[model samples]
Target: MQLKELSGQSGVSAASIKYYLREGLLPAGETVHATRAQYSAKHVERLELIQALRRIVGLNIEQIRGLLKMADDGAPRLTVLAAVQRVVLHLDTAAASGDRPTPAADAVVRLRNWPDYPSDARNALNVHLELMESLHIPVTRELLDTYSKAMDDVAGLDIAVTTAPDSVDQLILTAAVGMHMHSQLLLKLLALAQASHAIRRYEEDA
Candidate 1:
């Protein structure tokens, strides 16, 4: 495909594609002639991913470049995942090394017995646990176990999409952006469920 075809297929403007090329975000196509270059489906995929990262994930060009660079350099998926979690979007992935993990957080880890839980995620969960504790809300092992079971399914969905991705960059960015968008949907579902349960309980009590 030509550049114009790529732009049309990608739904990105030719000017913008040129800008991405200039910024080294999109690799140049094969030079088929003095004035023509050939592109392929890979270019389309990159452009779409780039657009998603920019418009959906809200990552700036430099961060996207860095993330893409790690993949291009043949970094492993875990390394890319860590970089995205820690350095890319600042979306729930920041934690200091010396910070303490709450008891509930540690318990959740022990129940799972899983190594490689991201520290920032544990810290994020700790914040919720502490808040509930302060509010005199009980967080029991049974509750955590149930929630953990539910999230295991969610994790499966999360991982399943990125499992066969073409590259580490594709996998991480796809997961990151998809998680960002679906997180809102998940919260909305939770709220609706809570509202329905509250209504049901109130009617029963009445």
Candidate 2:
């Protein structure tokens, strides 16, 4: 198919498709003429994936590029898919405005002004704020403090689990499958483990 046909079929604008091709996110089409190029089904699939990353996952252009590279290099689609699912879940929970006031819209503005926050956390915060705003929930300093504490606790545990040296791939696979198949059971296991460890530590201190 020609560039125009590809663009029309993908619902991506011709100029944007050209930009993606220029940026190396999309593969170059076969040159049929000085100004005409032919795109194939692979181009169409890649363009769809890129669109989903941007529109559904709320990833920025740079992040999308990195993801595309990883995808093309044969990294597990499950990993990328998991990350995208996480982002979409966050957006759904946090963007209560029914897709109108998504975190992506706020993140674009916030990143332009603030240079300190880590990109991932900043994006998450943007989603949280947008969600609150849409729900008319007051974002008090106390509420922020509580949220920060909760995040700190979860982050500590995540770091510990993710950093464990043996079979990181297996661990990720377990997490992915476990979370999918038995979410409540997984939560229960984690909760019991935490309680047991806390009790043991308290007894030792006493």
Per lDDT, the best of the predicted structures is: 1
Cα displacement (angstroms), candidate 1, residue 131, comes to: 5.4
Q: Model 2, 131: alpha-carbon shift in Å?
A: 22
Q: Whole-model lDDT for model 1 versus the true structure?
A: 0.78
Maximum-TM-score candidate: 1
Per-residue lDDT, model 2, residue 76, is 65
Across residues 1-206, which tens digit of lDDT does each residue of candidate 2 receive?
99889988999999999899999999899999898889998788777767765764456788667656755676664455455435433432443333344444344444344344334435556666776777998766555555455545664565464445343233333333333334355578779989999999898877
lDDT by residue for model 1 (106-190), tens: 8877887767465656666777777789899999999999888777778778768865687665786677776776667778989
TM-score of 1: 0.80
Q: Where does candidate 1 stray beyond 4 Å?
A: 32-36, 85-99, 116-118, 127-138, 204-206
